[model samples]
Target: MDNKKDFLKQIMNDTGKGIKGYMKAQVTLMIITFIILGIGLTIIGAKHPILISAGIAILDIIPVLGAGIVMIPWAVINFIIGNKDMGADLATLYVILVILRQFIEPKIVGKEIGVRPLYTFIATILGSIILGPIGIILGPLAAVIISSIMKTKKKTDNRR
Candidate 1:
């Protein structure tokens, strides 16, 4: 029916708009995250070149784990090998990176997703479970779209 076609078209238009907005926001957030990460890594490298180099490499792949993955194990290995000074150095670098990431990364990711930290965390977990890694990207997008729709509906209801 013509009415059905019109409704579908309208839904598509709204979804398109939401996706466009979400992408723009996400791109901005990604740039900011990279910049912050780069700066933090640079600072750490300046202070402790070896530990930081390893830490940054791991941080590049893992989002939330940051440098902890590499630095923690490196520290442990150093300790096991009876290199106390090396272990201490790696531990110090790890602590610094963890502190910086805790303060910065969450905010960057939160800004990018345009969702609160808690909601973003929940959405990521649920999204991954439901749609795999793609869900992590799409989940926040779907949340934004749904939020926009709810606001629009509420406005329309107010008029009625």
Candidate 2:
């Protein structure tokens, strides 16, 4: 019984570490996204790319809503005023940001936890769908917790 308890404690500790790793990865992705957008906008001839990027990134950090908060309206205004090129650029940036978060985040996070990426991706998507913007963060974490619990249970059963 003591050995079993110790094993469970170890599993819990590993799970905590894994969760921390994923949160770190998420923040890293956010910062990287901001930097990429800032540089990209500057390259594309936008004024004050740094400020724009900073605002977008801060909005992106907010739950559910993302850079889209700034990008969508700005794009629309540009298009309405006949600056189609700038509007298109803004739209493209938004798409790229989403793609970067969706694709890269799961792979790196799953690798951090030593599990299959598919499940993590599924969790992320489902989380977004179920919980809105915050779901993306929560979903992956919930999956990790569930995964850790199942893994521990399996190990304990095997020993039994």
Candidate 3:
């Protein structure tokens, strides 16, 4: 009974750590995104650069809507008003934002979760492919869970 309790406790602690790792990754990504968007908007001479960056960062937290929700409409509005240069710049910024997310997400997420970044990246991509949009989050999470379980099992086996 005591051994079982210890085992359970260990697993629980590992899970807690995993959760923290995920949180760290999420916060890091969000900060990086906000900084990049803020700097880009400032460089482009957009009015209220800080407000736009803040808005983008907040929007990024929503899995369904994302930055595109605001950017796409903004882009279109600029085009309609015949501000082609601004519209094009906005579109380009959006593209860069997306590309950066794709490249950094797996590495940062995986680093926090105790898995190799490459494996995490592959898992994320595969998850996205198999499960659609939600897969990105689910994939890395699943990997972390599985890896933690395996670590627990190995420790148990060694004790025996």
Q: Which candidate gets the maximum TM-score versus the true structure?
A: 3
What would the per-residue lDDT of candidate 1 be over residues 1-160, giving only the tens digit for each residue?
9555654565566666656655665454445445544565555344555454644554544434545666678789988999887777668766765665556543555565455666655666688789886777677667656655665566556766
Candidate 2: tens digits of C-alpha lDDT, residues 29-66: 66887798888899779999998887787777676577
lDDT of 1 at 26: 47
TM-scores for every predicted model: 0.52, 0.82, 0.87
Candidate 2: list runs displaced more than 4 Å: 1-8
Give the better candidate number (1 or 2) by lDDT: 2
Q: Candidates 1 and 3: which is better by lDDT? A: 3
Which regions in candidate 3 have their CA more than 4 angstroms from the true location? 1-4, 129-131
Least well predicted 10-residue stretch by lDDT in candidate 2: 58-67
Clash number for every model? 0, 1, 0
TM-score ranking, high to low:
3, 2, 1
Better of 1 and 2 by TM-score: 2
lDDT of 3 by residue, 32-113 (tens): 8899889989988899988889888878866645889988899899999999988998999989999999899878888898
TM-score attained by model 3: 0.87
Worst 10 residues of 1 by lDDT: 58-67
